[model samples]
Target: MATTPSSAMRSLDRAFDVLGVLEDTRQPLRLSEVARRAELHVATAQRILNVLIERGYAAKEETGYVAGPAAVATAHAFLVNNRLSQVALPVLQELAATTSLTASLYVRVGHFRVLIARVQGRNPLRYQLPIGEKLPLYLGAGKALAAWLPDAELHSLIEQSAPFTRVSGEHVTAEDLAADLDQVRKAGYALSLSERAVNVTAVSAPIRHAEDVLGALSIAGPSSELTETDHTRLIGEVCRAADAIAARCP
Candidate 1:
């Protein structure tokens, strides 16, 4: 006797849900976290995680578990095949080649953003987004992505993280971030000096296909390499690349 299609589908869905929780945080998450996020009992989630770990879809770390190497490969395959990445990767490649900086494309997923495609700078010291990584709404490259979000959504995100974010030099409060978002809206780009990491800096622009905000295009490198002048110049280049990519989006 063979398993029914519905039973297989149910198993598949649970597996995907387990995988999604790991992907969303992009950090090693505890078993409780995965269970809570997946809306499954701890024992059920643990069983799924064990299977995922056995198959390399998830890994166990000191803190918890993260998406594993096989999951990374799947994300790379998606980047190679996705319409968004297909349209945007060339632009990112050229930008990285010309600027000697890391170029990245991020698309909104649920309430967060996922890195779908990226081109790396050759420099030994450079920023990296190695696929299947998710980003918060109020951080570096995320700032440009966040600018276009609706008022209610944006407010919710800010209110959630504004406390820890206030530790940084740039955003001291939700109001400060709101003001920065306003600037991102006006200037058509966003820049972060030390928002995420102390020495990594980035400039980013929005990717819009028609009326919908599709994603963001960003160039990142060491803080020293991206000077004020360099940062200003990259803003225009990033925005231009974004428009070109958006035009080709299917």
Candidate 2:
């Protein structure tokens, strides 16, 4: 019998969910684990996995199941075709080299920020968000892009993640988030020290095109390195690099 449209759509959604779980975990997973994470029945997940394996979107391994070459190829295709990533690579390299800090580019997706490109610094930090990872928009460099969002969206994100604690052991409230966003608007950049991770410090500026905000450009490194560096100078470098990337983009 031929498949119905609604059933096909449901199957597609399940497949996507399984794919997301595999990619997000970044590790091999047992079939039961995949089913639990995808919120599907074991049999349903196995069926989806079989299709994915045959299509080279996933592979069955000795340990478990892992994302296959096709997933990587798809991410590569997006990066190669993405104008923002293409335009920002050289600038990210320059910013990382000049500032001696890791430089990254982030694009907002709903309530999350996704790292699209990054250049490692001379000194690596203990914590790093790899390319293609999605993180809450209220974290560190994410606030730079989030600052320009409309009030409703911005407030919603703050409410979701506020009343939280930083990796440095500081508590954050909604009011604190509102105040910080105001500061970001006033300064045209965001500065966070040990906000997301205990030893990480980040400075970020918005990348804008005309009146539209595109994303963010950020430099992050170990907090200890900043004790001797001028915060204002680092902020300036980040903002300049962000502006350069914005100007170069169409």
Candidate 3:
């Protein structure tokens, strides 16, 4: 019998999952290790690996398997075709000019968010996130992404974001996160101050296509700059910029 469409899609998903595992580790992995991390049986993994190897998306090393030239080409294609960066570039520049604070666009990667575009602030002492910087979804400006994630994924990210030992007593409970996300969804923006980096403050708003979130736009600066009056003004600016980006997107 021929494989059903759903079964083929499942296999495809497993194959992609194996690639993701390898990419995240940034090193060659044995078939058993890939299977364990990807939650696939060794045979299933080997089958996927065969296809990946044949396609030049993965290659076997003396150690194990690593992403091959095709994977780099795929990533390059992704960068070249990035709609968000295209839409966000000019908007980010305008936002930086308007706010006199650093503006950035962050896209959610699995288990993290990556800084893809940025415009520097006028101030010399501003908080800046360079392009390609990756950050956890639980802290600072990433609350915008965290707020809109599905419940199960949010919980999974929350667990991945923090370690068991919270010597600083900063462990966040599901209840607290739930409340925080509620406010973010309600207000259509996220504000985090001194949570991840002490003495830094960020205001972030989601960029969306109707209800589907594309990413987030954020303004970051020293905590001292976020006074009551500044908070009201900056949040509005961030929201407007985010809306503009969303309007430009699909």
Flag regions of model 3 displaced more than 4 Å: 1-6, 61-63, 108-114, 122-136, 149-169, 194-199, 222-230
> lDDT tens digits, residues 1-250, model 2?
9999999999999999998888777678999999999999999999999999999999999999998889878988989899999999999999989988889999998888889999998986766777888887788888998899998988888888788888788888999988988899888999998887787889999999999988999898888778645678899899999999899988
Report lDDT (CA) for all predictions: 0.82, 0.89, 0.83
Residues 1-250 of candidate 3 have per-residue lDDT tens digits of: 9999999999989999988777667678999999999999999999999999999988999999887789778767876799989989999999899888888899898768888788887852434555566787777678898889887988787666544222334667766766777788898899887777777778999897887889999988877756979989999999999999999987
Q: Which candidate wins on lDDT?
A: 2
lDDT for position 87 in model 3: 88
Tens digits of lDDT, candidate 1, 88-191: 87888899988888888898875677888888867534445567677776887788878888889888877886755522465367788888888998988988
Full candidate order by TM-score, most accurate first: 2, 1, 3
Count steric clashes of candidate 3: 0
Separately for all candidates shown, the number of backbone clashes (residues 3 or more apart, or on different chains) is: 0, 0, 0
lDDT accuracy of residue 189 in candidate 1: 90
TM-score of 2: 0.85
Task: Look at candidate 2 and tell me the lDDT of residue 146.
Answer: 88
Residue clash pairs of candidate 1:
none
